[model samples]
Target: MLKFENVSKVYEDGFKAVDSVDFEILEGELLVLIGPSGSGKSTTMKMINRMIPHTDGKILIDGEDITKLNAAELRRNIGYVIQQIGLFPHYTIEKNIAIVPELKGWDKKKIKARVSELMEMVGLDPKTYAHRFPKELSGGQQQRVGVARALASNPRVILMDEPFSALDPITKEQLQGELISLHQKLNKTIVFVTHDMDEALKLGDRIAIMKDGSLLQLDTPEKLLHEPAHGFVEDFIGKHRIMQNPDLMPVTDVMNDKPLTSLPKRSPERALSIMRKRQVNTLVIVDENDVLLGIMPAYDLIAKMKEITKIEEIMYPPEPFLSASATAKDAILVMDDAPHGIIPIVDENKKVIGVVTRGSLLSALSTLWIETEESE
Candidate 1:
């Protein structure tokens, strides 16, 4: 848990790198700070570890003022990763990862076990790569070694400053996925710095957008996309609109809560009456708890009125549905290939809560374009 209260940073030359920015990083949450060059994202991350002293305000970690703590002792407990990786060239991978543990006066046996465990944790084979020098590894491999070194001491907080910016796109994506998986497993509080909006959206639990050395907006990716705080926020997001990642937008934000429905045990005549009243040809059959049972079409009900008495007897199985947490893009893809006109949205218990149709998808797309135009 880290809190920045009215934090500001200014150089002796009168240049303000960060201007009274305030935010909190919750325990086990990955918070991303993103902005263009010189927007103070890197400076803000540096302030956490005291790499750059702030001009005013306070930074508290776990309820203690960092300014009162010894800088060296404080840094040892905080893992720091940078773009250049900064691994010693002469040191072997094993030695590199053991730097922090060795400094803390850990036993040789403990340090060796920690080195091997970390190498394996970051996807490097300990037996094969532990003894090798940093020069023997590729850029991506070196970056992974940097990450292993960061976690070598088992720190509670990790500050990553554009750590993956130098890697190729494919490797960057792979490392991002690895970091996400690692975060979920380790539950370490992380402060990530990036200029890439796509990276921020894909990885951050919440994103903090900065501009001109000031915090602009901070929110989840879904809220940030649908409801930008200002024109600058809208324009910044609009630049990446062409490559909008659907995973950032949940289906619940776009789903229709009201859908035509009928009781599973209802008479065919009653089902038909409900469908006609709603002006829909299809009816979803559900139990009292709204658990999806099947579907009934008006045509089928009308044709089988004389043959079947209950809707359940004439109802057919509904098409595949998605959970409420699924992304809007996933719904669009499912709807594009679906045989039925509507897709049911369900909860964890498989209770139908909403519906997504072609019309809804079109409306969402139209809104997106309209926002883009307004931003431009």
Candidate 2:
């Protein structure tokens, strides 16, 4: 919904903060702008709400030039949140959250309802905390109040400038999760600025990597991980790295879809034949609808060959399996110190679709390291 067209911001002293950066912020998408401290991510974000005016190029929202609109009116339509959690200490939480709505000339009843609703939405109990001053709340709580204040007018676009940077690690993580959940529910176009690559990968729909006031790369987290655009991009990613957060990497991204399988109703002889043909030690047992039942190890099948007829008789319950949406880090956690070398990937109906092996995980990691080294 927001578009930056060859936007550049050069100070009178001739230092360029942003240099001809162009990108579109899709509706309902969280677009994260990440880079080093001097990379102009914050400056790019400020240009959106006209907090910092651009020297050149046009910023359009739904095709209308933002420069043409009054600065206050433009800001009113776009919610802004900063790292400092700037809430007026003297103002009660309710009053802080109601600032925008009150300015828009909302009635007392409507403003009160909005304040209470927003407080509850951000996980603060309106009845208990609404009348409290900002000084009474913790840092995280104050940040939530800031977010509630930003959303007070129900703006279509939100610009968050390192909003979670000041909080402790645990609190930062909690707020990040809340922001992702809120994005999914509210579907507002968000332009987020962060120097932390991990935060960008975790939260962004598309991460824009910037350097020296220029756009370096912009892509989804998965693509960005697998294929960085330049040496600087690779080094930036390598420093923090995607492998460190495998939980953010989807199982589907690194799965063997054509895993060996057998039906539960199949005879032990048939199951053995399938395993031998596939050169696998174990066979995944599934029903006619491909729903995963369990697994049959070669030794288990061999020991019960004479006594058992159906594969189900010798099949042991499958160890923990992952959904298609599960992450590699999740698989690692499930497989840690476990006997199973592979984890079955299932769908919503428990149908076996793929398998991710420890070997695959190692290979993925090795490949990343190799790429990072090559980039250096």
For each candidate in turn, the TM-score is 0.86, 0.79
Candidate 1: give its CA RMSD in angstroms: 3.4
Candidate 2 lDDT over residue span 243-345, tens digit each: 5677667777677889898888898887888789888887888889999988777987888899987989878787778899888888878877435577889
| RMSD per model, one decimal | 3.4, 4.8
lDDT of 1 at 215: 98
Q: Which lDDT values do the candidates have, in the order given?
A: 0.89, 0.88
Alpha-carbon lDDT of model 2: 0.88
Model 2, residue pairs in steric clash: none
CA displacement after TM-score superposition, residue 375 of candidate 2 (Å) = 14
Q: Indicate the residue-level lDDT of 29 in model 2.
A: 90
| Candidate 2: regions farther than 4 A off | 250-279, 283-297, 300-326, 330-354, 358-376
* Leading candidate by lDDT: 1
lDDT of 1 at 307: 93
